[model samples]
Target: MVKEQKKRFVLDTNVLLHEPLAIYSFKEHDVVIPMTVLEELDQIKDRKKDVSRDARVAIRTLENCVGDAPPDLLLQGVPLNHPNAPDESLGKLAIFPDHQVTFANPVNLPGDNNDNRIINAALYLQQQSSEQIVLVTKDINMRLKAKGAGLEKVEDYRTDQLVDDIQFLAKGFCELEGDIWSQVSKVSSEKVGRDTYHTLMRNELEEESFYQNQFVIDQGDDFCAQVKSVNDRQLVLKDLSRDRLMSYHAWGIHPKNIYQGMAMQALMDPEIDMVILTGPAGSGKTLLSLAAALEQVVEQRLYDKVIVTRNTPEIAESIGFLPGTEEEKMAPWLAAVTDTLEVLHKQDESPAGSLQYIMDKANIQFKSINFMRGRSIQNAFVLLDECQNLTPSQLKTIITRMGEGTKLVCSGNLAQIDSTYLTAVTSGLTYIVERFKEFDGSANVYLNGVVRSRLAKFAEQEL
Candidate 1:
């Protein structure tokens, strides 16, 4: 039997910008980089945008891969030296001179567009090579154009995509049908101090999935508990009173629903280092997070201060041009935080004064996500909002900045992702929720309902 020929993948600039080390993802397949893509990367590397850093990293990654090879050898092929790739799985990397490719074919798209040039390069490869020639791009329009321009194959870079669909993403809570006890054959109860814990055999609850810090509630709302620990044989759940959870207040803000109650619990927990809240618009994500931050920072004095930051699409470029301090500049984007504060203090006689008083008392500082790098945030509550637009790499950069005695709360609405390069399934919020589900010190809650208003809820469901 004859062996199958290895495939050749032509990567787009957006793919590299989306993931700098994407070259290593196509194991045993030849990776091709067009000259147009290199030029695009060069142009983007110096921009005052967040993607500029990614562009530079992608360029550096390419340099490290085929930098030492001769120009002739680079056009031919250079063996990729990925440390993790197996000997049989190693592939070659080549820089294709798309500019040199003949554009005589009228079917060939005009060279005026970089995307068209990249597509044409892949088209040329398909005509010249027996191996499968595929175009890998993150841009939807580019993919459509490549396919329409007669490319044999095209695909999105899915090396970092954790879930195939948004529905499959972890919700951090499990709602069992009927009574949860009906599904369990046996359970052993224990009391430690004032807390009640129940240990049940893992096999008994095989139908129901459990993870560390995952909340479990019954459909009847009679029983609610949090998974304290899980092992191969047994699962331990900490009993939580549903009434008490509903009554739990944070900076005078109470949960509107059970989902928010769980989120509030996670936010208020001193043991949990990270809490991720994901939901639809007006679902109390920002409100609950801010309320909890204020409660922890001002009332409880658990942390020294409260730092609120979020990813603003034009922040990298527009921030410098905007007037006032960093906090004032960030005010426009962080209006939701201020709006939530107003809601929290609307009943007060001096709402503006109370907001200011609380802001000073809690030492609430609004920082831009662009400036979060290299700063050691200690003894503070960091509330990262609108994180759905961040890539996995960008999110990692911010998460690493968290120092000791700091609690990080990440809240985002996946349905409302604003980044052109990201989707709900590929979002950094989804990535971390799945990645940290089993971590003992982290908790995640997907606030289910829209509590902002009836009109907002109707819009969320219908529009």
Candidate 2:
């Protein structure tokens, strides 16, 4: 068999910003960084934005990889070495001087923008090199432009993407047909404390194995249970009352569907450290998360304070120009929490007073995702909203900030992502939902219905 020649990958700036260590993601393939990408990173590194941190990290990563090489060696290529894989030889890292490319080529882009310059670099390499030259970028338009410019291969940077399609994302629950007992040939039942537990073979359900903390409900039957433990042979299910789950209330807010019921149950459970909610807009994700936070902080006194934070698109660079304190600056983006509060207390004799009372009682603090780094948050009910716009690395930064006794509730609409470099499958919400589905202390729920309003439901379904 003929050994295939190594392909050279020309990375765009957004790929580095999306994942700072993206250079190592291509395995042994040669990685090329166009000077245009570096120049763009340099310009963005000084900006007062959350992405600036990523830009700085990407710059530092390039420095660490090829900093010590001489000019000729840098142009030629520096050997890429990683400590974890010392035994395996890796590819070389090279910096392409795209700005100096003045030769006329038929496939060259006419524009002088950074994107065009990067595409031109790939074009130059494709002409000069014998190996396949592929342009890797996160921007879809750039990919199209690269392909249009006659680049043989153009691809998206998908090393961080855990799923290819959004349909396969974990829904936190599985609905079974008919009664669960009808499918099970044998079962072992026992009682622990006030909860009833049943153990059956993994294949007794006649479906895929369930993950820990995943809920199982009957389609037309009254059976409802949660998987407390899962082994290779059998699963331990905690029998739950369907009526009881439907009756669960958090700060006077009751679940309208079994999905929300499971979400509320997970949110209110003291044993659960993280709860992820994903669904369409008006699916009660924000409302349920806020209600659960308020219940834990004010009514139940399980937590000291309620810290409501989110990845605000505007807050990246314009937050400094906003008026008042950090919390006040975050007010506009966090209006969903306030709106939910109003709905929760609309029946009060003094709605305004009740709103203020709950706000003060819960000690709610609106925080920005940019300011959440390097701080340990403990004994707080954290509601992270609009997380669909975040990347996997960005979400990891926030999740790692949680200290002891912190309960994090992440809610987002995958279909409503605002990030240009992210999609429903690559969103951080989808990443965490899939990553944490098997964790015993974490639970995820995809709210299935639109409970906001009739008009909103119609819009969500039709438009």
Candidate 3:
């Protein structure tokens, strides 16, 4: 019997920065770290950003993997899944040969940069060994470069992939039988703790499984409601129509569409620790989130205050430096915040100084994402806007800052991500929504309406 040789994977620096634990992802395969990768990691080990933090951590992990061994043992590799190892090990980690080796064919690259150097090492390894040597990276251009250089194997690191495509993610709506309207609207119209109660048939359940806070719409009878509770075949609906809102008005910005109504339902639920909203431009994602925060913080006094955080892509990429205090610097990037505030003020018809007064009295804080690291927030409503621009690691950092009695509402339009490394499927918003879909304390809704302006909707649809 012949046993198949395990593949040897060469990881780019970006993979480690994206996930410090990427070493273990190969799972029983042989992993190789090019010397150039170590040099790059060393160069960026002192960086103050998350990339540097990841580099230092990965270097430490690699050092631990190869602790005090013979020079030959490094190339031979160390067990990743060894029972005697301190961490979980599913594969083995090794360092590529330091000596020269020939590639399959002659090649020339545009530049001798770090990425190209890694590709060169991978090519050399492919020629030296009969087994497969694959170059794994998140950078799209690197893959093309490797392919152009005649590398036989290249792939994106997807061990942590939540869903294959963005379409596979939850859309926040569920359909029921046509006759469900009669049974739900008439029979279970009675109120039960923040929502209406209805017992559905096991046949109605069928193959459809409702998420903890997913919305339900039986448009046959104009039925729009939220799933209050899910118990086997028993389904409870919470009406979020005009009459069922917690108060007559939520910070004077009312939910205009059924999706917005669902947003309000999740936002107002004290039990829901996290809420995700995804939609297109002018879909009221930010407005609904801000309004709900105001309602909870100011009207109901649910939390101590409201803290807003945004990954300002425009600011992060261009200009790089903003002069002045943090709030003043954030103001230019938060036009949406200003606009939402204008709408709220116009609807409330308050005095000229009232908005600022409420903002001050309620302790609303506009914070930059850079300083968000290592801060613990408790009893606050945190809104992370424009989250599509964030990476999976960036989103994880933000979410981990959450403390007790705090609600984190993240909203972003997946169709409008600005990051070069992020897409609709890989954006932080999609990552969180898919990962948290099964949790009982997390809820999400996708809004498709663009009620801000007809022209805006036209642009979203046509342009």
Candidate 4:
């Protein structure tokens, strides 16, 4: 009988950072770590920076799981490669004896980079063993290089799948049932006060029925106190603040644009402590969020200040070392923020002083991700722009900074993530939407059509 051969797999540096447990992912199969890959891991692990902290943690976790190695030998297994090696030199290392393991240094690779060396090592393994060899990495360019070099079996270490639950709620409408009204009323008037009524109105419920208002509700009972509504094309907010209602109409936003209308409703919702907006490039997520925030600070006087921030993960190349003050360093990325603010200012018919006066009184502040740590924001309208660049952990950090009576508005394009480790499904914006859908204090809106231009919408669909 011919024995079944075990497949051999080699991992690149990114694959390990993405999923350190990948070594154990393949059951009873041999895993190879090229010398160059180890060198790359060592460099990342040695970095003394905040950004590399997570990478260091990953390395430590992997090392803890798979013991230490010998001083002289580059590779070690469950059974020592050399039994006669000194006990002090041969540190404890986990090696699988049932699997045949070997290391190779490929002499001739097109490039001397770590990625190329990994590919070459996999090729060498394939040539030496009867079993198939698979190369695993999270780098898109490296995967392409592997394929171009005639390595057919390459796989992405799918850490991106961990956050897939977020994508399911990206474009869906949540239902608030009929019986939640009574339960809400049972809470103290302060707890379920005017904000509760505002939530109901924004949900587009019938003004007549006590429970018919379309809003988020927290009910103590499972069956009797439930919130339910069918997903509809148009979202209507009946009793919004006058300023917000006027601003929405002025911006040419209405039920005619269903998705934008829904997003507007969420933005206008006073009861919701958190709102998440996700869409593509031309969806007007930023403009709508800015408009709503302006209305609250300028007219309603509900919050003490308006705080705007963004995660500026570079789109392609770095913008280079910016030369300026803190605000100047942020100016380029914040042009869109200022543009929206200017539009709102332009709509004001009063003298020029009115816009400046409002800005001064409301304490409007623009911030970047660099200054967010260790700050507690209170009674403020906080806008997290371009949140798609944030990881789930990073988003959690930002959200936890919200203080009492503060409302957080997060907007992003799920399809346009700029972070090295994040994608549509794995971004913090999508993460919040999925986890908070059932929470009464949270609302999500997905804007579909582009409001930028007719040509832009056409380009979005066709190109």
lDDT of 3 by residue, 240-305 (tens): 553454233477777786677777878888999999999998998888888888888888998999
Each candidate structure's count of clashing pairs = 0, 0, 2, 7
Q: Which ranges in model 3 have alpha carbons more than 4 Å from their true place?
A: 1-5, 45-50, 81-89, 97-99, 104-111, 177-195, 202-208, 228-248, 313-321, 347-352
Report how far off residue 329 is in candidate 2 (Å). 1.7
For model 2, state the Cα shift of residue 182 in Å.
1.4
Model 1, 1-463: lDDT tens digits are 9876789989999999888888888888899999999999999999999999999999998898887689999998898877565464668899999989984466798888899999999999888888899899999989998888888799988889989999988999988778878888889999999889999888866445679999988877658899998888998999997887899999889888999989999999999999999999999999999999999888899999999999978999999999999999999999999999999999999999999999999999999988999998999999999999999999999999999999999999998888889988888999999999989999999999999999999999999
Taking all chains together, each candidate's TM-score versus the true structure is 0.95, 0.95, 0.87, 0.64
Q: For model 4, what is the C-alpha lDDT against the true structure?
A: 0.62
The whole-model C-alpha lDDT of candidate 3 against the native structure comes to 0.78
Measured by lDDT, the strongest candidate is 1
TM-score, candidate 1, is 0.95
> Mind sharing the TM-score for model 3?
0.87
Name the 10 consecutive residues with the lowest summed lDDT in model 2. Answer: 103-112
C-alpha lDDT (0 to 100) for residue 53 of candidate 2: 95
